[model samples]
Target: MKVDENNGTLAEARGLSGKKIKISKKGATPPPSVENKMSVGLIYVNEYYSGWKELCFRVLQSKFDSPERSFAPDQEIIEALKNCSIGQEMNLKQVQKLCMPFIRFKKDEAREVGTQALDLKLPFSEMDVLRENLELIRRQLGLEHVEVLSAFEVLSACDETAHAKAGENVKTAESESAVPW
Candidate 1:
């Protein structure tokens, strides 16, 4: 199975079926930002694509060029996003329906109605849907958000990375400015 980009849900994996994922740099695009390196890497951790790392090393080579220069037709970007795990397509409608209870948590957990989701029992329909097939969802898309704790972990990691980078840039600028003739 695969996810359709048009719909953002799973579908038949087409050419990716049966055969293992074979990533090629023939049309790879470079990573757009430093953060995307980690984002796409997480998606690739589970699959083995040919020349995947080499392609990443190549795309990162673009950063070596002066800001005025351009290195594109980024093989890493194309291959990373085009791999089998992304799926043939995705059905936003279906995902929306499935994630309703969690999304509702966004608003209710905000104003905190009736002690938030902690106080209330999920409706039978919601519980039934969430209780079943989580393993399947993880196997298919790796999107098992069963615990609020895990989401916090992901956020904390991102926050730490962003803050560290910001501090580095600030320190570099300050040091350069402090240099005087």
Candidate 2:
């Protein structure tokens, strides 16, 4: 993936088929910011066509511009979440959901979350209704403060907020430390 932070564009990702696609920074859920590059981040892509809605979210690791792995929730995950109770303990798979939102592949190194080995592929494709629900899951988990702790933190939902606040503090400190001209 080629990342160009200079322009309004966010990043350019090459698909499995070698097609280069650029995700604009304009309408991004959380616009490109200094906080996005800290720790973890999420790049959500959504599209609506004739009678069809397609969207896919990629997990960003290290920096928002670099994506590791992409995932769309399968049907089983959706159903289980629909029946789940808020504050109810999430299973291993449910916990896995949190990691699904933020993985960056490292060459020659195996990436595993908890116990599940991650697939090191950028699986961006035409969106499906069920697949697109991945974003919803992230939001629900964060909003409800579901019991998945480590996984939730990896997903970057809550972490992003913390990072953003920290970024603000850094800026404040920088200005305060500036020497008068």
Candidate 3:
């Protein structure tokens, strides 16, 4: 599979000689012979916290597209989540305050929104409600952890490793040069 840098579209190379082929976007139907010969699999690259946040928004929007419970998340709210920070913890009350306006709740037993059930008799705090909704969202998205290392952090780690290896190479070179043939 080859990725188009300009449009970020993935396309399968047609021949063994590396010829570019335009794969149809309409259902992306592969050639019969290639389909029979190749097994397709999805590979995620450069995925980080921002990508997860976007996926979460998409899942929530699709699951709760009703007029009563609109899932239109704003950039500010998503940015405030800071899901990329490894140890950053968001205040439950603060997240609840930010999310309450966008989410709708009903007191009736028959009504439901997203994964929230309105059948419980006990009153729940805004934080509790938000927590439940978030948990449901996480489950639906199949995410085990919300926190992820940012691209910058990953690059920094790679740089550190590279530098350490370069230092070792330099030491080896110096020792070899000092030794008599």
Off by over 4 Å in 2: 9-73, 83-181
Better of 2 and 3 by TM-score: 3
Clashes of 3: 0
Hey, what RMSD does candidate 1 come out at?
23.1
Clashing pairs in 3: none
Which parts of model 1 are misplaced by more than 4 Å? Answer: 1-25, 28-124, 143-181
Clashes of each: 21, 0, 0
lDDT of 3 by residue, 42-136 (tens): 11122222332333333344444454644445443344444423114446454445343433322122134333432222233433333434443
Candidate 1 lDDT score at position 173: 36
RMSD of every candidate to native, in Å, equals: 23.1, 20.2, 19.5
lDDT of 1 by residue, 69-158 (tens): 333333433433344222123243433343334434332442333222222233233323423534543455423232111122232344
Query: Candidate 1, overall lDDT?
Result: 0.31
Worst-scoring 10-residue span by lDDT in model 2: 49-58
For each candidate in turn, the TM-score is 0.18, 0.16, 0.19
Better model by TM-score: candidate 1 vs candidate 2: 1
